[model samples]
Target: MAEGISSDYAVIELWKAVKSIKKDAQDVSVIEGNIPKVAEMVMEYILKNINYFVPINNNLVRPKTYPIDNDPMSVNWLFVLHTLNFSLWYPKGTKQWKVDGKKGYFGLCNAIRRAIEDGKPIWNPEYYTKMTKSELECILQSDDGEPEIPLIDERLRILHEVGEVLLQKYKGTFMECLKLSEYDADKLMKLLSMNSSHIGTK
Candidate 1:
């Protein structure tokens, strides 16, 4: 992500980092078949569904139940969701956390949807500023029961930070920020990355 490095070069560096970290971190044989299959499927999927850049479609991105037709509100909802989109790893041996039969990040999506459905003020920055642990717990409840999303405290802090920033600088809507970026992907990525450092810390 350094300045002057083309995306191709950044990808190469990322692959190198992955190779180095995974080399000693696990038994290579354990992931030998899995990694290749995963990579092949990812490549195939991307090639099959490649798309031209378009303005984000909030309806498509979020669960159907929490539809917010108002463009600014929809954008605010997406911003809230993205604020929690980091470090979803669970304990090594536990059942993978799931919601509505979806695992990993998809599961997280449903969990957020359910939280909103259950009336969590998911799109409101002022609500997040006063959110409590119990309230967050309610938001992260698993569909299968007895499991919870990891990093509740950290996620809560991030939520608050993102919400507060949206309120203060963008009139509580990330759509304003998006407009400031003129709908440019690079500008938006930089904006998000800069905000990431301040996540959960205001």
Candidate 2:
């Protein structure tokens, strides 16, 4: 859509950022040289204060928010959630995911890619964080209107295999990546949250 309007990114950015300031502003005839500089300025304005935008039309959508950018929680949440849902996905979380130690980050990062595509939240993986032991048991028992615990390792294994994608490949859109069952993911996150913290890595 932007390319159809003009040869320059600056002009496209100007149109996206502004309404009818005057025909002169749109004219671009007065501004000569440094078109890239202008575009860079516009991008800086946007990237620095992305929170200020409220898009005008269906043609415009905000870029995906990232963990490295303004909102750190989004990235951290998805990463953690991935770990909780499957131990095999990342090396950091639990032994459950080790899966012969052969399948690891590749799996986690891929899982992250899927979740980013889906726009679902990557929840905080530290299962015990903010949750009490009573909370944990209630979760385990399917209390508080949640699902029952997975006592079965096979189910956990499936989760482990799927969550292994998030560690590296899918960087820009962790929040949008696909999600596991909120109930199951939450339980695992809580469990890892409690147990995984003090340990050193292999």
Candidate 3:
């Protein structure tokens, strides 16, 4: 996979960004630096508190019966899907505000799972890269009388970008980026953030 874009380049660029900030702006400095001991201490603290790092929970948006089920690619695809999951609120005074009693993020998750059941290629990046608005609308369809989710075009764009990046840089699996992180929580966060946007600096 050497022919693919080097993730090392991203790490190096992040370091450069970290160094360019003013001394007074020490947010990234607290997270990264040449101080090995401080870095080790941070990692140890994360390890000690790993149980609290869980993002998924009973109250979160997820498939009821475990849709992915040992499929790493599907799990990664879920992460990619969530990267752009937002703005699901309906207009004020709308009578229909839910998709089969699931509203907002949960409603979105329900619709996506239903699409997968209906044979949409939810786990295939190639399919999403060229997904059409009509197709997306179909997949995102709400229950009858319910308001549709907002930002259809932005969702499609995010899906396209995620598909392109995964195929080009991570060999069609977000786990590749995870592997590159080598079990370090900070590096994993940085790698994932590189795909989205930078924080603290901008």
User: What are the Cα lDDT values of the candidates?
Assistant: 0.70, 0.40, 0.67
Q: What is the TM-score of each candidate against the true structure?
A: 0.63, 0.22, 0.62
Candidate 2 accuracy as TM-score: 0.22
Instruction: Give RMSD (Å) of candidate 3 vs. truth.
Output: 11.9
Could you give candidate 3's per-residue lDDT for residues 1-202 as a string of tens digits?
1212223454466667657764557454464455798779999997887776444453353456345557655666576457646766644345433555766665666776777778887767788878998888788877874456677887887888777888888888777777899868899888888866622222
Q: Candidate 2: where is the Cα deviation over 4 Å?
A: 1-66, 78-82, 85-103, 124-202
The C-alpha stretches of model 1 lying farther than 4 A from their native spots are 1-72, 197-202
Q: Judged by lDDT against the true structure, how good is candidate 1?
A: 0.70
TM match of model 1 to true structure:
0.63
Q: Ten-residue segment with the worst summed lDDT in candidate 2?
A: 93-102
* lDDT of candidate 1 at residue 97, scale 0 to 100: 59
Error of 2 at 199 (Å): 16
Best by lDDT: 1
Rank list by TM-score:
1, 3, 2
- What is the full ranking by lDDT, best candidate first? 1, 3, 2
